[model samples]
Target: MNDSDAINKYHLSVERADGQTDNLVVSEGHQQPEDVASTRLERVNLRNGGNVDYQEFALEQEMILKARGASKILQVCVMLPLEGAYSMITPEGEECHFTPNQGFMFRYIGEEVTFTLPGHQTVRSLGFCVSLDVFKRYLDNQIPDTIKPMLQPKEIGSLPVPFQIDNFMRETLDRNLQVEAQGSLKQIRWEGTALLCMALVEEKLHKAANPETFSLTQACKQKAEAALELLMADMQDPPCLADLAQELSITEKKLNLIFKSLYGDTVFEYLRSIRLNKAKNLIEQTNMAMKEIAWTVGYNHSTNFSKAFTRQFNITPANFAKKARKLTKVS
Candidate 1:
């Protein structure tokens, strides 16, 4: 079969699509009933003829990946929550919230996990799956001695603390997601990106003197999370920073710091990023007019929206929509 057909056949399988919203569901071990909301997925087979797979998914909603019914043998799950919050729940009931721009490393041999995403907004995430042998082979020389032991195949009670996704890391991952290649070249590109991402994760995790295990007080965590939800809910006209702080009964300075600490960006930066991503999705998934889409996303003028879209993605709204339509046809 051709490359596109091959990708469709092996790269992804959607159990069901929500007619109203674009959703591609993936469950643990490829089992039924587990839902993962994603609009795009690419599965790449290793070039060395290995059984390992390098996969990426762009999620659109919060989903629950059940652990009890999983069928596949998962060695390591390297996760990047590009745009939304995530909760990783262990079988023992230990749960932690992962903020945006944080990388999660999950070893799933002896442990069972249920991953849940936010239900309100779109969450773009990238995941890499590898066998235990494959993981050790690739990182044996690269990983430092101190962190090497953690890589050993074993189950633990708690999930490893997440690390920051710095500017350089963000650029690399974003570029990889936008890769446009065909056939063997596509596979090679994916493999290289996966290794690079893995290396980044290791480097960041190693440098962290103390990983954040979500030790924040339960009340504070819930309140801070509620603040995030409020901001995300209204993209066109979100609450002012001071108003948000007052609503949460916190100082503006403290609120800003909390957002920056949890997510790697300020409140303004995060909101702008979310808005641009929403615009991109609308361009790709809907046939709405530019003016209407702009207004819907909270941009008062089409020109302003186009300018922002161009600045963020380096593509004009019209051009992006045209290309998206073409790709939809080709796929």
Candidate 2:
């Protein structure tokens, strides 16, 4: 099969939020027998044989809704609340919420959940599911068998991990809901959306499992790399911390933090190291005098440069040049 076909076949199976919104409909139809307000849940199908959903629903009054009947499936879920204050109580008495700007994910199986939503509030939430097997694959099954069950908290003990929903995820969810692809492209679009969400879900799950893991987001990394490029471009006259941070639209303190995390050195120290390394290269590769080499690498005086070179490389600049010359002759 072609690549597109293979990808489509995977069919991300992006399930709607546990409670149907958009065009999704629950098994019991419009209102549960215990109904107090209007509700609509519909399972939408993509044209290319893939299933994706876009649901927007609301409770007309202040009332409790039983999420659904007990199920026999183990699943991982992700949800984002678009508007209003959404609240739910899991079967285990865990009172939970999904507010604006926050992402929520949890694991459960065949258990009922209750929505304790506010009155006259419309709930627009997007959620998707990843099977346990698929989730384990992404995590390399390193999840100890002992802790597998604990991945989803026991009844009354769901340790739901709350994280900030990044821009990429928010935009993707919005586009997936609004996108209307044509012909053969619809399934691929659906699958792509599903695949991206799965990746995001896996990443969040990894963080959830490893609480100590520090995620260096894309935005911060880009800024740090840009700063490095600027410093490398002109080692003889590197930018000062304040100026460099301003160019990168970051605080000087944040720039240093990024450098320390990525390179194990502060901005000043990193710049010094760069100058010393450049000086060593020029010393070995050129016939420049010690003072010239020092100037070339941003040091004002040969004595200062020699001190730093010795500290960094355990050899004086003159001695390094002599050793480099001897090596060239021997070769």
lDDT of 1: 0.61
Segments in model 2 whose C-alpha atoms lie over 4 Å from true places: 1-40, 44-54, 58-60, 138-159, 182-187, 204-331
Shift of residue 260 alpha carbon in model 1, Å:
10
In the order shown, the candidates' Cα RMSDs to the true structure are 12.9, 22.3
Q: Each candidate: what lDDT?
A: 0.61, 0.59
RMSD of 1: 12.9
Write down the worst ten-residue block by lDDT for model 2: 6-15
Error of 1 at 296 (Å): 18
TM-score of each: 0.50, 0.46
Tens-place lDDT per residue, model 2, 1-331, is 5432222221111122344332112431122222323444433333333233434545444545455422434555566654445676766777777664466666655455766555444555665544566556545777643235635543534446565554456556666756777656765665566567656655655644654324567888899889989988887788888999999898887777777678866787777788889888887788899899898888887777875675466455776788897887788
Best by TM-score: 1
TM-score, candidate 2, is: 0.46
